[model samples]
Target: MKRIIISGCNGKMGKKISSCIRERNDCTVVAGIDKNPESFDGFPVFAAPAECPVQADVLIDFSHPSALASLLAYCVDKKLPAVIATTGLSNEQIEQIKECSKQVPLFFSFNMSLGVNLLAQLAKKAAAVLGDQFDIEIIEKHHNQKIDAPSGTALMLADAVSSVLKEEPQYVYDRHAVRKKRSKNEIGIHAVRGGTIVGEHEILFAGHDEMLTLSHTAMSKEIFATGSINAAIFLCGKSAGLYDMGDIV
Candidate 1:
């Protein structure tokens, strides 16, 4: 059985993952670390990883980016593998993650949904086939409570498309502010936030008289929770390295 420790145990995604684990028999949450470390779901909750006494085979983090430093320290000190699902991290923090991965197995992804990553793969293919004939635009929607604009998944999709293109395309987040014609080598990304949208991303390829759109809609948070759990299982017994959903999926 995989003994897991959940970071951000009090958050929405944490609770969701905990619930999903309860339904499975192969793994269990040995402990949890959260700022508001109230024992809500039978597992012992600590305010920080240093305070936790229980040992775990792996750690799954869905907390804020600010918590990354302490969490990385704990993981490195304990020689624990980690699956990081937190989004909107800075370049420096990402570099830190890469550095820490040298000491421990680290799995990180902007979006945990398998469908989203598959969408990225499909977008890459479309961009390669269509070449410069089609204009590309990405539209992403999430809940209002989301603090980050142009969800990380949106950028992931954009990056996938950009990677396959002959010439790297510029990412244009807003066109309304700039009263100019769209550039041929630009990828437009738009964001929509309202209600309780789980997550939605649409990639549009527009040509002279036709448009091809690839989209993925997450109806609930279970997709991410389940994906994270799967990632934890995949990371177990793996060597120290930086991993992502592509490694598993």
Candidate 2:
């Protein structure tokens, strides 16, 4: 059986993943690390990975980006493979993950839903076929408590579209009076945060006389937990490398 260490064990997603893992016969949670250090269903909680008692086959992080450095450092020092589910990482933090990938297998992404992964692939195909002739736009919605804007999944979708178009798309989050018209080379990203929205994303392709939209909405956090667990399972015993949901799919 694969032993897993869950980071951010006290948070909603972490708790959901913890419960999900217990139902699975192939793997189980060995430990949980969170700033809260509170027990969830009797599992001991550590303030940090360094303090955790168990040696895990994989570490799944759903913590904040602010804590990423220390977590990655711990994993690197221990040579433990990890999956990073947290979003809002700066370019520097991303670079650190890439650097750490040389020492331990790392799988990271903003969204873990299988549908989102498939949407990225489909968007790439559409962008490649349509070229610059089509205008692309991404809009996302989440809960009001979410601190990040233009949700990371939106940026990921935008990046996939940009890669196929051969140009880095400039992101425009807000528009006011006197704003210039949209650029053909730009992909607009809009975000809405309100209510208890689990998650929602829509990608639009607009042409002169036609339009197409690809969308994905998350009904619950359990999907993400399940996907993260799947990623952790896939990363076990793997060599050092940077990977995402696409690699596993």
Candidate 3:
């Protein structure tokens, strides 16, 4: 059985993962670290990573971006494999995570849903085949409680499409202020946040006299939790390196 430590055990995704893991027998959550440090079920919750004494096969983080530094420190110090699901991280923090991966197995992704990653892959392919003939646009929706706009998954999809393009395409987040015509070389990304819409992403490839749209809609959060758990299991016994959904999917 794989032993796991859950960072941000009290948060929404944290609690969701904890609940899902309970249904499985191959892995168990040994301990948790959370800012609230409230007792969750029978496991101990630490106010910070330094206070957690329980050792595990891997750590899964779905906490705030602010908790990244300490969590990574603990993981690197103990050479623990980690699956990071937190979003809204800055560029510097991403670099930090990559650096820590050199010492321990680390998995990070903008979105944990396998469908979303698959959508990203499809968008890249569509962009490559359509070439300069299509005008690309991305639309993503999430629950309003989410703090980030445009969603990290949106950027990941855009980046995937840009990778196959001949030139770096301009990313346009908003066009309300500028009353200019849409440029063919730019990819428009729009974010919608409201109610409890789980998550949704749609990529549009608009060409002359034709429109091609690919989308992925998340019906529930369980998909992400399950994906994270699977990633944790995959990381166990793996060598120190950076891994993403692609590694397992």
Candidate 4:
């Protein structure tokens, strides 16, 4: 069995991942790290990674971005492969993750849902086929407790479309701030937060008289949790490198 350590063991995604692990017989959670570190589950939870005595084959992090530095250090020091599912990381932190991947296996993804990543692929193909004539807009919805605006998956979808366009599309987060007509080469991304909505992303491609929309809705957190668990399993024996959902799917 693959022994795993969970970072942010007290968070929503963390707990969901724990549940996913329990449902499987091929892996076990040896320890968990969280700021609150209360033992809600049978596994031992420590306030910090350094304090955890359990040895693990891989690490799965679903924590806040603020905890990234310490988690990375722990993983690197222990030579543990990591599956990072946290969103809203800054550019510098992302660069740090890339740098650390050189020393240990790292799996990172904007959205852990397989369907969402597939949506990104479809969006890219639609953008390539539609060309510059169509206007692109992305709308994303999440729970109010989500700290980041314009969920990372929104940006991922935008990147997918921008990668194939003739002119690199400009990301427009807000149109109200600018008093001007929408540019032909701009991709608009809007965010909605309310209630306990799991997640929703819609990509709209609007042409002169018609609109084509591609959307994905996440009804539960289990999709991401299951994906992360799979990622951890996939990373177990891999060489040092940066990996994503594309590698798994």
Q: Which lDDT tens digits does candidate 2 get at residues 162-233? A: 887877777777766327988887888999999999999999999989998999999999999999999999
Provide the TM-score for each candidate, comma-separated: 0.98, 0.97, 0.98, 0.98
Q: Rank the candidates by TM-score, best first.
A: 1, 3, 4, 2
Against the reference, the lDDT scores of all candidates come to: 0.95, 0.90, 0.92, 0.93
Model 1 misplaced regions, further than 4 Å: none
Candidates 1 and 2 compared by lDDT, better number: 1
lDDT of 1 by residue, 1-249 (tens): 999999998999999999999999999998999999899999999998889888899999999999999999999999999999999998899999999999999999999999998998899899999958999999999999999998999999999999999999999997988899998999999999999998999999999999999999999999999999999999999999999988876
Better of 1 and 4 by lDDT: 1
Inter-residue clash pairs, candidate 4: none
Instruction: List the RMSD of every prediction in angstroms.
Output: 0.7, 1.2, 0.8, 0.9
In model 1, the clashing pairs are: none
Worst 10 residues of 2 by lDDT: 169-178
Candidate ordering by lDDT (highest first): 1, 4, 3, 2
Candidate 3 residue pairs that clash = none
Candidate 4 stretches greater than 4 Å from native = none
Q: In model 2, what is the error at residue 243, expressed in angstroms?
A: 1.0
After superposition, which runs of candidate 2 have C-alpha atoms over 4 Å from their true positions? Answer: none
State which candidate has the highest lDDT.
1
Evaluate model 2: give its TM-score. Answer: 0.97
